[model samples]
Target chain A: MKITDPRTAATGHRVSLAVSLWLSLSVLLALVLISIAVGKYRIGPGELVTALINRLQGGDGEVPTVIETVIFQIRLPRITAAVLVGAALAAAGATYQSLFRNPLASPDILGVSAGAGLGAAAGIFLSLPVAGIQLLAFAFGSFTVLLVYVISRAVRGHDPVLVLVLAGVVMGTLAGSCISLLKYLADPYDQLPAITFWLLGSLNAVNPADMQVSLLLVGLGLVPLYLLRWRMNLMSLGDEEARALGVNAGRLRLVFIMSATLVTASAVSISGVIGWVGLMIPHIARLLVGPDFARLLPTSMLLGAAYLLGVDDLARTIGEVEIPLGILTAFLGAPFFLWLLAHSRRGWQ
Target chain B: MSIDIAGLAFGYPGHPVGSDVSLSVAPGEVLCLLGPNGSGKTTLFKTTLGLLPPLKGRIAVDGETTERWSRRRTAQHLAYVPQQHDAYFPFTVMEVVLMGRGAYVAAFATPGRHDREVAERTLRELHLLHLRDQVYSQISSGERQLTLIARALTQQPRVLIMDEPTANLDFGNQVLVLNQILRLKQAGITIMMSTHDPGQAFYCADNVAMLRDGRLLCWGPTDEVLTSANLRSVYGVDVAVVEITKTGEHPGKVCVPVMSDPRGRADSEIQAPPA
Candidate 1:
């Protein structure tokens, strides 16, 4: 029997995917350049390149000191943090979504963000320095997921994923309550505002040190995900099917949760509790590239980086006062996400 | 390859669903498991696939104990096709089939060109190459089941364990899947599948195992095991195992339910149709 071949349709899909990837990459590159050039201390493209070249060539002192500092010290670190945090969160979100087999699963679904928020709040209440606060956030974030994992493991004869998610929800709520308690007890004039702002999230305070540390942690997390990208496809099929397909699903899940949590914690540590990017970017990427993790991961990272950088740029330049990134992301992301949901012909399943 | 299950007890930890169950499927033979809901057929299949630890006995593949084998090694010998269900992502048929090559692909690597070739060839064999680019979720239920079968086939396993492959399918699709099962059997692949319908067992199963309440009711060659008495015993409903020997067609068996009054009244108490 002859079947009508849709080979041409398939080829069209392949071509579209390729085009989408290239378009995302180009957008990201353009956003990076725009982010570098359009800051308050507006440096022209020529001056920016010259300053970068001068900095790279052993600080030749040809560029003015103020320009050099703005490019290298302030804007560069903040931009790098934006991209890294964006990519990390999006990657983590995609991982969790796939692992949970739920489109609604986000980077913080496992309580990492809540734990980080609690840790940062505690740090601000204690009047700790920025570095100390970041450290606490990272530590607490990892600890929360570990605690949830242990709790899920302790509960037997239930669906493991459901158990894990439930534990995370419970733990996340507890962490949120703790943060609220901290907020209630803090000195309203100083610590409360600091805690609130930290919770709202910002990249304005990101320094070279924070950028480097997060970069390292995010890279560490992403390597395992990249290596096991193919296997990640089977993970959504659930533990039983994955095992039947020769993947040790339990072990693979552990590896994935740890990796995704590491990236999320690291991103949250430096950037505070930026929301929506993790939850939204992966969906947008899936709409663009379909759900093949090998393609989805990279596409998510690129789009996420571009998205946050663009949002951050707006945060700085859209008004006299810089808006918290969390607010901007929600304000922008929710509507776009809804629009995507309504317009896309593909079902979320 | 052949599979041997000796005194196998299986279930999740702290909950034993079935125990002391034993069965085997020889090379290229089809073994059909017939059971009602919650009778532990799925649990048994999971145990046989090594997804769950056999609580009491052992499962041997090709006469070798598979207790210590890695999941990859187990999958090299066997693959599983789960019931038709919604996939979370809209992966294309080709992508889903390519995932079956996970056992052969390196942990740190994606499926290579050769893996794609195997997936494509499996799809071709199943006549599913035409739907290769179609999203798995968008396909008809029968096509989804076939796609899953193609995935299992791409694993290049000698044995395939399917959990109710015909469940939820319409009549034509059910026959299509059954015909595919027979085709696979003819291709010398061992298949162990569970079915809600005993007639399905009659259709393709060389051997049959009837399960109820976590225990085997009867098991042997299909004709010997799937009698009307066995069906009534297992399902608590009377059914006549009828043979149809239509001319110019292969003889087949079908289970026709013998309905009774729902009020527990004897047939004689009901007003009979005017003679």
Candidate 2:
């Protein structure tokens, strides 16, 4: 007999729910504060806080030029971009896991991320503006998952698990080849650097406009899920069982995939294809508070925001030159992946 | 609305599991299908649910063939609890049960207040109210069965089909699942289950359907079809159809052990003291 309280089975109690929530929020807040503190130009801690306070107050007439530049122009946009991208990735991860009913399933399981990365790179090599690249990334990323869904439905398996995953792999490879072709055709010095930077992933180019478009659509996609978290909970059961209970498995899956894709595409648009956050964030979230989606969604959002922000911080300041955020995440995240693979009784589900 | 099974045959691609089966479940009645291993019991249930297409005949719910109604509409009137559910995701017990409202909810619409309440009540009925928040993967076998039943209850279905609902449960949980079925029957739900255990079926089932070699051997009131003679023919084995004969202070169980005697084994084991 399945029980509701996760604490009673295999893990700690619901009380840990509160602790996880608090920990996520505190880490997110700390990351935000730390992110606000660092940049190409550093502002004194007190002055930074003062500038932030002044900026928020809209009375920043006499602020020091150094503090003003750091807070208003450089740090504010990057920090906002980091938090939003992280939250979106983590939320997309949780959504993908639920939609596919596999713990090892990630947003890229349906080739969405890879498709978007290829689109962004192609846009850059073709001399599309930064905004056009963002748009292309969002469109192609969402399109990849949609294509996977349609093909899987038409293909051999009615169950979209392995079919979609395999379809994703195929599409991802095709997109990757297209990206290679674009690289071969590019002006070596200019477009090669552009495509390479886009591939490695960075937060250097995210602006308020990209963030705004993503925030609006991605937030809309997430709200319905948050409100219908209980339904998402039902969706985790096998379709046969779930339908016997009354869930329309096909319709709900479509909704879930589209919604997850929306957020994932948006995140990709802003972050330029950070690899591991979406794959790993929800797993850590599950480890923290179990899988009740109401708790799980919020926990992922918080941890994802915190984690990505922290990783970006290290990426920006750890060396004299900026390293791509994806490299930093892969460094910290791949070992966790290998550990999860080695120890988790069921690996890469 | 009774479930009418008329001359139905079903099986996998290369194996002909069962055929020429006819049965019905009256409103508020419990029907038990008894069969040995490889008896096509699961296939019969699947055909009725329209999960697998029947090769020979038809299954009707409320006097109409299953094909006449939309799956959702048919599903609204009936629910099934699978023999086992290891194929689920990491959803919660409450969430699992709440999926019973799937057909009722509009496309892309969330579950409303009534749906949540129904799920909660279903959990309460299964004595799983305390387990509503638990993740699905970590639950015990018995609890898993109850959770499935709770999901069925959330459907508010009129006909309930279960395939070996007690296969994983111990004796206590077997009783527990049957008790829930009995409760569903009393609420005017027609219940059908393929069970291997005869003793449990004798008490709970209004009718018993027996299958062998893809054919219905016999089906009728439980007492009529569950006789020792019929049991022997169906199973082709020696079995004691025990009976109670109470006499004063010393009660006796009249052990009717099978007598496949070479001679008239009246004194068969009586004179043999050592093996």
Q: lDDT values of the candidates? A: 0.90, 0.78
Q: Which number leads on DockQ?
A: 1
Q: For residues A67-125, could you state the per-residue lDDT of candidate 1 as single tens digits?
A: 88887788889989999999999999999989999888999999999999999999999
Residue pairs in clash, model 1: none
lDDT of 2 at B136: 60
Residue A99 Cα positional deviation in candidate 2, in Å, after optimal superposition: 1.9
TM per prediction: 0.94, 0.84
lDDT score, residue A25, model 2?
88
Q: Give the Å shift of residue A103 in candidate 1.
A: 0.7
Candidate number achieving the greatest lDDT relative to the actual structure: 1
TM-score between candidate 2 and the true structure:
0.84
Worst-scoring 10-residue span by lDDT in model 1 chain B: B266-275
Residue A172 in candidate 2 has what lDDT?
84
DockQ score for candidate 1: 0.62
Worst 10 residues of 1 chain A by lDDT: A6-15
